[model samples]
Target: MGAARTSDRRRRRAVPWVVLGLWIAVLALTSPFASKLADVQRDRAVDYLPASADSTQVAKIQDRLPGGETTQMVVVYHRDAGLTEADKATAADQIAEIAGSHRLTGEPVGVPSKDGTTLMYPVASNEPGIDEKARDELVNDVRDVARGGDGLNVEVGGEGALATDAAEVYNSLDGPLLYTTVAVVALLLIIIYRSPFLWLVPLFVAGVANYLSMGVAYGLNQWFGTSVSGQSSGIMTILVFGAGTDYALLLVARYREELRRIERPYEAMVAALKGCGPAVLASSGTVAAGLLCLLAADLNSSRGMGPLGTVGVLCALVAMLTLLPAVLVLLGRRVFWPLIPRYGSTPKARRSLFAAMGSSAGRRPRTVLVGGALLLGALALGTLNLPGAIKQEDSFTSKPDAVAAMETLGRAYPERSTQPITVITPADRAETTLADIRGTQGVDSAEQGRTGGGWAEISVIAKDAPQSAGETTTIEDLRDKLDGSYVGGPSAEQIDLKDTNARDRLIVVPIVLVSVLLILIALLRSVVAPLILVAAVVAVWGAALGIGGLVFGPVFGYEGTDPGLGLLSFVFLVALGVDYGIFLMHRMREESLNGAEPVTAALTALRTTGGVIASAGLVLAATFAVLTNMPMVQLVELGFVIAVGVLLDTFLVRTYLVTSASVALRRKVWWPGALSKEPADPVPPKEPERVTAAAH
Candidate 1:
């Protein structure tokens, strides 16, 4: 018997090493693929558009044209007062030099503003074609030679230059985003764990999970042809670290509690897993299911994000559940260092903050519930203040050179658009299409350009400033008036993006709510419980956006909201915010199963799981907040709204409102489930004397 016991211990000791070995092997295999994720990421307008959109059709046909896709740009020469004769001469000379050095669709045409303060040269080339790098190089080369001096400002602005600048910002995100997120999580972990060594364990495991997610994402892109943009990949990384750390915190907290009762390290770890594993699995499953709903979205970016986000969350789940447990067991109680939980040791008695909050909630559930609802409703009204749909030039938090140029053009040519609206039609219908475009009410001019691949391209100028009301109307009119032809350009793409996002919200929102509600029902085994959770998250989402509406323009100085912000934020908040609900509600259900009264169960659950949930929320919110510091306005806005939503859900919604609602509902919170009805007193064991005597 002693020998058998010794063998069991040996086997247990070997398990952790085996798991570690397998992880190393897996990481080694995935590393190469992971490094190539950025290579396959595409950020073009068409890459994000719906396949059925007119802009998408035009872009596709352009790619099949004679020189692939044409790169269009405008070099703006401006002065504070008026362009001097020398400034005009310099602009002309530079334009000639650009013409001499590069192949052009036509001679660089100078369009001077009626005010005489600005002279712009429209340039088009097919040399760079569809090569993103070559296009960026072309734009940079133009900037180099078109230097402005002597009180004159020269700026490069156009579809091609704007795209190049946006690409640069995205390319730079991988490094700083990863680094800052790691730093933020590492710092938060240190504070939460209060152990120098323990924080490193989860942080390292999260990093591994991040690398694994990237590899899987790249594989998705390669094998399934998933569209990955800087935005999606960046979001995937955030989920890896945020959700991974959250799982770690829950497991570690449970393990600490178990260690005080179980003598063996491996046994305590097993006990911890038995206690929290179901909740963690359900939490990650909720997130994965919510994100996967994006598959129903028409937008390519949103749809691709579903899989990439699911990959991140699932990868984090795998690592935290497997790798984290193995490492913790191997390190045993020592991993916790100064605050280590020794076997058979009792923790100091203290009144925790969550206990106090829960006590107050239990005291007046109705008031808390009503007040919280009213507050959330009031905050949601702020959505009315949200700015209009974001403009292309306003997409960046820090203005790029292209944005500056566009601004100059906007001021200089307030009555006319320098940016052309591209129209693609069958070559056989070129003359009729050109004539139709010219007759369009808002068109200032229309000119036929290159013809290839059975199609002809025509560039149309609007009668008003770019992306303005008049310009948008003109685009709509062109699309409606022109038959058997597609009207597209940068502006057209934005219109399609806005419309697609609205459609996706209508379709995807209900699907997400239903998916999440069903999962909650299955996991909690109560309809009312799931409904409460879903509603609470939805409220949090609305309030968060309301907060964004109030601040996005006034505080952040942003001019417009991201088109995808509404749908994406709703998906994330619903999926992730419910995570805390799961942690709290699952614990409450456990207390009820153990025969605690409803109010007692709710308060007890809150007291026990509150600290861990709060920690996880802080970590998640902070990781996303790192995005607010990013360069792109869309990312910043997304990060801000999500972070705000998380905080609200954590402090107000989860701790107070959810607990209060559960308390007020009592056993009905689990209606129709066995717990809904009070269990009858166990027959006192029939023979209590015999049972006690036998035990003694």
Candidate 2:
């Protein structure tokens, strides 16, 4: 019988190895597709536009036209004081060289400012058409040919150049962002664990999860026609690391506690999983569900982000819960070398930071609650300081050549727009649309550009520079006048984006709230507790944005807020904020179930879980903060707000305010639940044999 039992134990040990082997095979199968994700990412304005928008329609129509999507550029030659004869000759020679080398749509037309300090050649081509690579090459070739000397400055800018520049920035982000995030997470893990071997486990697992997520994201794009953009894909990486590490922290903490009690590593892991698996599952589920709510968004980029983000969270959760546990069980106590959790050994008791915080909150819960509320409210008022919508030229932290050219155009040609407002009309009604476009209030010039496939493309130049208020009005007037014609360009795309995002906020916000609240209610088995969590996260969202308002313009020098910043940040913060809440509340409920008084349960929960929550928050916040170092201003803004919000939620809201509220409310914090009912008779609480350091 003993021999048979030994054989059964040997077979059980092989199970995890088999599971790991399967995971390895799956990753191997998915790796090639993952590498191709960058090739499929589309960042064109039209790609992000709402389907029903005229710009989106225009893009489709244009693609069917002779030129497909036109590649436009402005080659600017500037001599600030005044263009010398030599400079003019140099500019003329470069423009002529460019026109000679490439297929010229029209003779390179020179537009000189009144002061003669700057001269710009308007170059448009359809040779590259809709191929982004071809378009970028054309722009690069043009820049290569256009050279400057004798104090003459030359820059290439326009829609195509802007797109090329943006792509370059995106391409650069994947490597630096991934490395920085891994380093940050590794360093933080080393600090948190204080062990040479332990930190690498979760970090390595997160890296694997990221690799798998990339493969799955690529598959979604190829199989289901899901749109992927740099922004969405970058955020997916962040989620994989941020959320994945958080789950690892909680699991390892619980595993350590169980290691001190259970004889075998596998048994200890099993016990730890049973104790904390539900909370981790629910936390990740809440994040996934909230992200999935983005599918209801009208904007294509926002809508596509839903599936990618969900895949990332779910992938991370699976890797952390399964692979992490398997690896830990296999490695056993040696995984925590130098601080090994020996069987039956206990950690020396000490006054924890959370204990002191909870003790103070317990003393004057109402005052702490009121003070925290007032502080968040005051910070929210900073929203009034936020700047207007960010202009295209202002969307980069460091101005690229294209943006520099546009800025020069803005200054030298303030009276006329450099970019065209594209109008795609049915060939049958082309004449009528042309008449209306010409008659538009701010129109400077209108001309037919390309015609084919029952459609005609007309380029309209506005009196005001691109993205200016007057130019926006002109496009709107053109759209209002021409019934079937589509008005689209960079400026119009912005308008559509802003409108779509606002509409999405209205649609998506409620869905996220309801979905997350329902999930919380189900997990906690109580109404009041879920409501408190929801309300707390909402407040954190506002305070975070308000804090952004205070810093973005006056402090960080950002010109405008991203149109989707508020909505996207809210979704991320609320979902992630509630994550820590779930940990704390779950532990509180556990203690309460074990017969601890309400106040003691809340305080005890804080004392034990506080350090883990803080560490997770730091990891998440640091991972997101990586975005601020990227080149794009929109990304920087989004990263700043989300990173700041996580810190606030982690340190202040989750740690103090929630604790205060719980202390103030007592059993009422869990009203409408069986646990809320006062115990018939008081029972002494059992002494904690192990530190409840895992995320609740």
Candidate 3:
């Protein structure tokens, strides 16, 4: 007996050091790859295109050409009154300097608008050769040489310039987003735990999980050809912090509860893990299963995000369940400082927000359910008000130089398009294809641009501005006229993206719903409960998007929506929103199995898990809200919609509506499940005991 006890003591002492050493080693191994993630991130339209898109084919062909993918840009010089002789000379001189400094595919051609207020030059170069840094340098170098003053405006625009500007925005987001997320989580944790030292534990663990996720993400990219975009990568970081912290909250809360009963800290932690580990695992499993369903998506960015997000949530779970417990046990109860949860200590008696809400919901369950359903249905109607597909120029919250230049072109060249539509055809048909492209309806002109690898590239300019209806007609007409050729460029890429997103929604949405439903069924072993959660999350998504629709245009001044916003947001909201539902329902199942009556079980589960769920929701929502401050409009919109949905689900739906429905339905909520058949005799209901708020 003495030897066994000594051996146990030694094992306990070694656990923390072992776990700490493992984490340090993980950090060391992941550091190099994690730091290089930014290097592999691709921001170009082609990088995001659907695999079967003509735009993707065009990009592939361009990459195989002699110059290895040309960077096309437009330099616009404008004067409202008219272009003076000096202005024309300055424009020409600037173009000359640019051509001299860089390897141009051909001589830059200056095209004067009919209004005489603008002189635009079409510049193309292959020196960048698919290298993002070189392309950005080329664009920046050309912009530096084309400076304007004295009422003359100059701006560099087009696909290459736009890509550079977007990349800058994405790169800038990496640091600020992480910093802001950390600060927010720390502050919220401090408030919830009220212990200066306790909050740091989860935050540090989450940071470790985030770092590990980044390395794994980079590996996935290198090994499996996963497409990493700014949006996908940013969301992955958010999930790591948000989801990781959520798991920590659940584990810590249960641990605190277990500590009140068990004497030894390590033994208490073991009991806590035994009690709630399955729920945490089920929640993370559902999130991973739902995210993995994104593989069915046609959008490359969305598909890649699925795996990266799964990696984040799973890593966070592992850290919280293993590393966190080890650290906490080593530190003991003193880590809580002024608010340490001592064994044999009873919590103070106070009415909790959820308990109060549950009381009201219990009294009028049907009324509350009906009202909540009506509210969600009404909010969902806002989707009809959402704007159309976003144009590339309008994708930024603040206008960059590329957008400004495009705006100038729109105003000065109102009757024509400045952006080129690239078409690739058989080299033998170059002459005839060029002629046919020029003759196509809405074509302002056509020229043979590049020829290599048995292919000829033709550039076509439409009669109307880029993204306008006239240009759309012209692009379609050209594709129809040149059936064997691939017609693509910035405009066609957008069209393909929009079409592909619609298809992905039809496919991936159902997959996500089914996948999540299956996981819930397996976890809860109840068909009715899973359906309710699914319905609730779907309603939350609709209502959240409706809120976005209501605000995105009239409040935020955005005129367009991202093509895949609906699908991506739905997947996130459904998968993540259901997290709270799982926690609540899992606790309720525990209560039922422990012989509590239906209503008692429901209210007790809510009373026990409410504070943690609320804290988790706040942290998750705040983390997502951080994205709204980003310059990219898509991130802002995505962040806003999801944050709103989570808040709605947390406070209104999860607390009031779900609780009320559970009360009204009683045991039928678990219909056909084993729990429903094994109900104990009914006990008179009483107010649920309140959990300590510090557990949050």
lDDT of 3: 0.91
TM-score per candidate, chains pooled: 0.97, 0.97, 0.97
lDDT of 1 by residue, 1-696 (tens): 678778888998999999999999999999999999999989987789989999999988998988888899999999999999999999999988888888888998799999999999999998888889889888998888898987999999999999999999999999999999999999999999999899999999999999999999999998999999999999999999999999999999999988887777788788889999999999999999999999999999999999999999999999999999999998888899999887667789899999999999999999999999999999999999999999999999888999999999998888888899999999999999999888988899999999998999999999888888889999999888888899899999999999999999999999999999999999998999999999999999999999999999999899999999999999999999999999999999988877678898899899999999999999999999999999999999999999999999999999999999999999899987888987777222121011111121
TM-score of 3: 0.97
- What are the per-residue Cα lDDT tens digits for candidate 2 across 1-696? 678767767876886798799889989999999999999999887898788998899888877777677788999999889998888888888888888888878888788998899999989888887999999999999999987866788999998899899889988889999999999999999999999999999999999999999999999999998899999999999999999999999999999989897777777788899988988998999999999999999999999999999999999999999999988878879989899998878888999998999999999999998899899999889888888888878899998999999999888987889998889889998888888888779999999988899888898999987887888888888888888778888899999998899999999999999999999988999998898889889988888899999999988888898899988998999889998899999999999998999999999999989999999999999999999999998899899989998999999888889998998999998888888898889778876564332311
Query: How much is 144 displaced in model 1, in angstroms?
Result: 1.2
Best candidate, lDDT-wise?
1
Q: Relative to the true structure, how large is the alpha-carbon lDDT of every model?
A: 0.93, 0.90, 0.91
* Pairs clashing within candidate 2: none
* TM-score between candidate 1 and the true structure: 0.97
Better of 1 and 2 by lDDT: 1
lDDT of 3 by residue, 76-161 (tens): 99999999999999999999999999999999989898989999999999999988999999999999999999999999998999
Candidates ranked by lDDT: 1, 3, 2
